[model samples]
Each structure stands twice: as C-alpha cells, then as structure tokens.
Target: MSETHALDQIAAWRAAGRKTALATVVQTWGSSPRPAGSHMAINDRNEFVGSVSGGCIEGAVVEAAREVMTSGVPKTLDFGVTNEMAWEVGLACGGKVRVFVEAVE
Candidate 1:
C-alpha cells in the first residue's frame, strides 16, 4: 500500500486509542527492495500495514515490534543476512536493511 494510506490508517488507529508501533526503513545497502522512509504500522493485535522489505525480513521486524511494545522502548534494528541466512530469508542478493521501530505516541 501507499505510504499516505498507511499513515492515514495509523492516524485513525491512534485516534481510537489503539497501541501501535511504527516501523520505518531508515537505511538500506546494496539492492534493497525498499528505500529509506518506507514505513509499516503494527498494532497490538499483530496487524500490519506497509513494508520495509519485500517480505524477506518482515517476520523478524514484527518480532522486534512486539518487543518494543512490551518494553515501551523504541529501537532501530539492523538486519544483514549471511550467504546462508540470506538464502533462508530470501534476500539472496546480498542486501542490508536498517529498520527503525518506534512505539507510536
């Protein structure tokens, strides 16, 4: 989905007092599918919108978001796959991504 649409949904969720996390792709290296500023919103219910990668690493990111929700702390997470993990995660092109996960206020 488009970023604006995602942001709008987040705003609506916030208006309803839903606990939500915002994850943004702040950096990328070498052939990343998503660029900087790409975003995704995950609510307490484990629902999500937008994307930081092309599904290669979103599960990890969602797990990170869950941690942030529990700790009430925001964080920036970097994920880089080795040849083996890269193949497992499907990012076989040797790319790296930095995701900034924040608890929405």
Candidate 2:
C-alpha cells in the first residue's frame, strides 16, 4: 500500500481515539519486496493497514508496533535471510530490511 494510505489510516485511528503506531521501511538491501518509505499503521486494537514488507513480516512488525505503542519508544528492527527469524517470519527471500517503528501520538 502507498505511504499516503497508511498515513490516512493512522489519522483515522487517532480520530477514533485509538492509540496507534507506524512502521516504516527505512532501508532495504538485495531483493526486498517493498522499497524504503513503505508504511504500516497499527492500532491499539491490533488492527493494521498497509505493509512494510508485503506479507513477509507484517506480523512481526505489528508485534513490535504494539511494544512501541505501550512504551512510547521507537524501535528499529532488522530482518534478513541471514537472521534465523527470516525463516520464521517468512522473509526467506534473500533480502534485508530495516523497519523503524514508532508510536503515533
């Protein structure tokens, strides 16, 4: 999904008084499915919109986003074929991605 659509989802969730977090694809290497700037917006309800890594790691990103929302602290997550989690998260495609997750006030 487009970054604009993701931002819109964040705004919608906030308007509804829901806490939200945003995960953004900041950097990518090799055969990344999505490019940098991709966004995924997750709400306190665990609902999400858009995607940072297509279908490869959205669940992991959502989990991280939940932590960011609760702690109000941003985190940068790295995933690559070299990492064991790449297989667990289904990112076995030889690519690396850096996702920055932050609570959206």
The deviation in Å at residue 30 for candidate 1 is 0.4
Best by TM-score: 2
Q: How far is 6's C-alpha from truth in model 2 (Å)? A: 0.8
lDDT of each: 0.82, 0.90
Cα RMSD for candidate 1? Answer: 2.2
Pairs with steric clashes in candidate 2: none
TM agreement with the true structure for every prediction: 0.85, 0.94
Ten contiguous residues minimizing lDDT sum, candidate 2: 84-93
Q: Name the runs in model 1 displaced over 4 angstroms.
A: 83-90
10 residues in a row with least lDDT, candidate 1: 83-92
What would you estimate as the lDDT of candidate 1?
A: 0.82
